[model samples]
Target: YEKSSTILTSNKSYGEWGEIFKDHVIAAALLDRILHHCTTINIKGESYRLKERKKQGIKTGLIRHNSTEILEN
Candidate 1:
């Protein structure tokens, strides 16, 4: 996929990947490869669902968040 773009999304922090996958070595390696050339779009919990609810004039139970942080290597 050279010259093509790849986008990955996640709500959990990279540090927790080991716990989620139950393997620190593998999780770290996977994270390393992803960070090698790809960009990380760190999106918070609000996501699209929360955004649409607000746009439709609905009151969501939880407070909404808005932002995306880019992690580049």
Candidate 2:
């Protein structure tokens, strides 16, 4: 980081990141260096996991009008 720039992306927020890094001092130091020369971008959108689940439901006929019969027949 000192010799070159770095970029990072996380699904967790800053306040929720302590749980991710699992070390207070390390997390704080890393965050300090990152925030020192970084442009933080907060991307808000539906979770990719949920979107994939919906797509899987459509593919598997889980959301069909006759889901059970579609499966049996």
Candidate 3:
């Protein structure tokens, strides 16, 4: 485990992982192992996709229908 590197990226915070795995116990155990030998980096900013859309003069509006959302130009 020493001298090894791993990268993991997630938009969800640690507290929200339980919902993802559908079991708090499993999430906790997995996090314990991963975090035991991990370095965390939190990034905060506008999404790169949105920034690129804005730069390209693409409309960033959404049209909703029922539970689905369609992006509009």
Highest lDDT: give the candidate number: 1
Residue 29 alpha-carbon offset, candidate 1, angstroms: 0.8
Query: The CA-based lDDT of model 3 is what?
Result: 0.73
Candidate scoring better on lDDT of 1 and 3: 1
For model 2, how does the per-residue alpha-carbon lDDT over 1-73 read when each residue is reduced to its tens digit?
4687566777677776677888777878877766875566665644545668776764433332321111110
- Return the TM-score for each candidate structure: 0.64, 0.54, 0.70
Ranking the candidates on TM-score from highest down gives 3, 1, 2
Candidate 1 residue runs with Cα over 4 Å from true position:
1-3, 51-65
Could you tell me the TM-score of candidate 1? 0.64
lDDT (10s digit) by residue, model 3, range 1-73:
7677787889788899999999999999998888885567665655656778878989878432333222221
Off by over 4 Å in 3: 56-73
| Model 1 score (lDDT) | 0.78
Q: Tell me how far the alpha carbon of residue 71 in candidate 3 is from the true structure, in angstroms, after superposition.
A: 36
Off by over 4 Å in 2: 1-5, 56-73
Q: Write the per-residue lDDT of candidate 1 for residues 1-73, one digit (tens) a residue.
A: 4587777766678999999999999999999887787767776557566778889989888764667677777
Instruction: Look at candidate 3 and tell me the lDDT of residue 19.
Output: 100
